[model samples]
Target: MGLEFLDVFEQWANSYDESVGGQNREYKAVFAGYEQILEAVTERSMGHVMEFGVGTGNLTKKLLDKGLNVTGIEPSVPMRGIAEAKLGSKEIILDGDFLHFPDIINVNTIVSTYAFHHLTDKEKNEAIAKYGKLLSKGGRIVFADTMFESVEDYTNAIVKAREEGFHNLAKDLETEYYTTIPILRTILERSGFTVGFKRCNDFVWLMEGEKQ
Candidate 1:
């Protein structure tokens, strides 16, 4: 059995800003960590930096501020509009899911936050494989997201969510596509990217890869 649950990620498109899930000090810290990775890896700016699921331009604004030429792709129409307004980069951004793309073009470095878990397990694997092929050699890929060690871990997340004033609808997601450190490593390895992960805390982790 694979993942059958659908939270229909679009549900959060408009209301995300109001939700506690969207506003947090930890989230800002996570974004800063990604920026640190970007600064460390990106020695020379070549081609375009792309971020899948660029919601509301949180990280997008930071990257843009750093003078990085970025192209953002997003699935939710409302979210894409929000990102466009927030990012103010009309020409470089596109609105569509990564699956629809024939290939993710001009990607020298890819950064995604809280977006990878939105895909089904199979799709996640396939997307990683495609990402490997599309990226320029020696390109770095950075990601930050919430993941758990097990089902019990998700239960704990639910309790944490209760404190945050939302429900952990992702509890039924058992494929580890949503939360497995081991799977994160294996998928990237099989996809032809070198895998690395850093634990931010009990709830989140940063996964990085090199297109090799």
Candidate 2:
């Protein structure tokens, strides 16, 4: 998978919250799902929480307001700066891609949104293993992003898009790699996590896993 999206994200960072997609119903639903994920994390363990790819502190600010100690990792300076301005010293936003961040052990909960798609399936599985080790017992992982149950599901979406006259959109979807939700569940379970998931939209889903 290409990281060209990073350049787009860099350009979109400052205006992300105000972008046209930001005002769409899909984005609103995803944001609601993010809140639910954070609420669930707080219920599980209020100790230490880290958000991978915490762009502009959208959910991070909510975490802080609810009084959970939060840390965020964001590679984009522009996005991180906006988050920093909103969060102040209430939380720390680390600078680096999440996989390379060395001090992640013993956290109570890990959350990420719309970011893991940047990783290939192999890399995503590697991350699952790493997250398994980083979490404390009974800790949880909360993720919200584009996920499908299988390749067929992904393909069907594309076909449906083309049928619905979204040819240009279908063309874009054809190029990206998305994690299969069932495969992700199996990987997390192998890493000792019991998982659950909910669909947020046609191509987006929210997943939760509790370390067992």
Tens-place lDDT per residue, model 1, 36-119, is 443433333345788777777767777777788888877666677777887666765676665654255667887777677777
The numbered model that scores best in TM-score is: 2
Best by lDDT: 2
Provide backbone clash counts, one per model. 0, 0
| Tens-digit lDDT string for candidate 2 (75-105) | 8878888888887752489876757774865
lDDT of candidates 1 onward, in order: 0.64, 0.74
Candidate 2 clash pair list: none
Measured against the true structure, the TM-scores of the candidates, in listed sequence, are 0.75, 0.83
